[model samples]
Target: MSYELRDHTADVAVEATADTLAALFAAVAEGLTAASAQSVPATPGDRFEVEVAAESREALLFDYLDRLIYERDVRLVLPADHRCTVAEPSETDRTDESDDPDAWRLAASARGVPLDAVAAREIKAVTYSEMALERRGDGWRAYVVFDV
Candidate 1:
């Protein structure tokens, strides 16, 4: 899993890639954390857990990133690193509840120090502009824009 910051006209953008959905989510979380502050302390001060569900993959990514932003704003903490697990319903796991039976679920844990420990920048929200998540030849890639 890896992430890189891209230049945006009025906000911040991140591109992340990984071999699996869970790793992709974790990489994006790390990207958002890196964009929110100049530096994070080496010590892991606190751990925050997040769980989110959405009907589709795109919605799931949006909600997941939004939750991370909410955690940063409300808790005044910078997520230095994260681990995520995504449960995407497979054919065997699907039921006949709806036409699209594959519901996406994500559970994540983030570790970070207080925002006061470093120079911080406020990320207002995660935006849909230029957002994308797709499969490559061997892995998945995601691009997200943040309202800074």
Candidate 2:
């Protein structure tokens, strides 16, 4: 899994590619964290779980990054070390009467350090502009732009 920071007209952007959907998400999430922090602590401080469901893969990526921003602000930390799993709705979801039976789901665990402990920057929000998630050959790629 790898991610690259891209130049945007007036914002920051990231493009990540991985061999699996889960790794793709993890890479993009790491991009978001990299964009937000100048330096993150080497030792873990706080660990958190993030769960997000969306009707589409694009939306799932957006919501997942947005939720990380929310978690960072609320927890006063810079999140990192993302491990994620992305899946389509399963039979159990239908049996459980999920609100959106076709929604894609992402479950992730991450570690973070206090925001004040690092040199951090502000990312106002994750925007849908130029956002993309698609399979390329046998791998997946995701691109996202952040509103600064």
Candidate 3:
């Protein structure tokens, strides 16, 4: 997995690539954390779990990143390590394209440190203004902009 910081007019952006959907999500999560703080703790002091569902792959990525931002803002935690899994919609769950109960489901955990422990930059929110997720030659790539 890999990510690169991109230039955005007034926000922070990240482009992440990975061999699998789950790994792509994890890379983006790590990128968000990296954008927020100068450096993460050598080891995580705590862990938090997250579960989110969306009607499409793009929306799922958007929600996943937004959830991480929400966790940081509300709980005063800095995500340091990440583990995530993406489940494809089951046959029964794929009724309509937009109303599927399991169109995309993400199960993730963020290992973090207390906010006060590290110097951080405020990432106000995650935005859909410039968000995308798509399959590439051999893997997947996602781009996200953070409202700073």
Candidate 4:
């Protein structure tokens, strides 16, 4: 239903839940805002198209956030609403792509922050070392950490 934020040693902890994997990923975006409050806005503005590929749902979640961290490091992106469509790799697949990923990428716009603009937060990275995505009953749940 909603993303929850928690305190960590040198970063922030995030969690979200949904009825499906796609929804769960979307919730994680909201959780990011809570973690990067210094650079993120209290109000949302624009939503961008973001596409990512990975081997598993957990990996997918990690890759997605790590990509965001990359953008953040590059000063091109900040935390905001994200709508993700997740799919697993096929058994016979060699090269990895999330559903022909080139066409499945997403674009998000932040309400309070601007990419490549001025920011004061020091969120260094989003790590997959602790990321998790699992189905509990009829809903999906996930957790991730951001290096601040």
Task: Compare the candidates by TM-score and give the number of the best one.
Answer: 2
Q: What TM-score, computed on C-alpha atoms, does each candidate reach? A: 0.89, 0.94, 0.90, 0.72
Question: Which lDDT tens digits does candidate 4 get at residues 69-92?
Answer: 666555455657566676555444
What range of 10 consecutive residues in model 3 has the weakest lDDT sum?
93-102
| Tens-place lDDT digits, model 3, residues 6-51 | 8799999999999999999999999999899878877657788998
Report residue 36 deviation for candidate 4 (angstroms): 0.6
Off by over 4 Å in 1: 90-101
Expressed as tens digits, the lDDT of each residue in 1-148 for candidate 1 is 9999999999999999999989998999889988987677786578989988788888999999899878877888887689999888566655465534567878898886788888888889999999999999889999999998
Q: Which TM-score value belongs to model 1?
A: 0.89
lDDT tens digits, residue span 40-122, model 2: 77975878999999988898999999999999989998889999998897656654654677889998988978887888899
What is the overall TM-score of model 4 with all chains considered together? 0.72
Which lDDT values do the candidates have, in the order given?
0.87, 0.90, 0.87, 0.66
Candidate 1 accuracy as lDDT? 0.87
Q: What's model 1's lDDT at 114?
A: 84
Q: How much is the lDDT of residue 117 in candidate 3?
A: 89
Query: What stretches of model 4 exceed 4 Å from their correct place?
Result: 38-47, 90-112, 115-120
User: Residue 45: error of model 3 in Å?
Assistant: 1.4
Task: Pick the winner on TM-score between candidates 2 and 3.
Answer: 2
Q: Give residue 141's error in model 3 in angstroms.
A: 0.8
Give the range where candidate 2 is weakest over 10 consecutive residues by summed lDDT.
90-99
Name the regions of candidate 3 deviating beyond 4 angstroms: 92-100
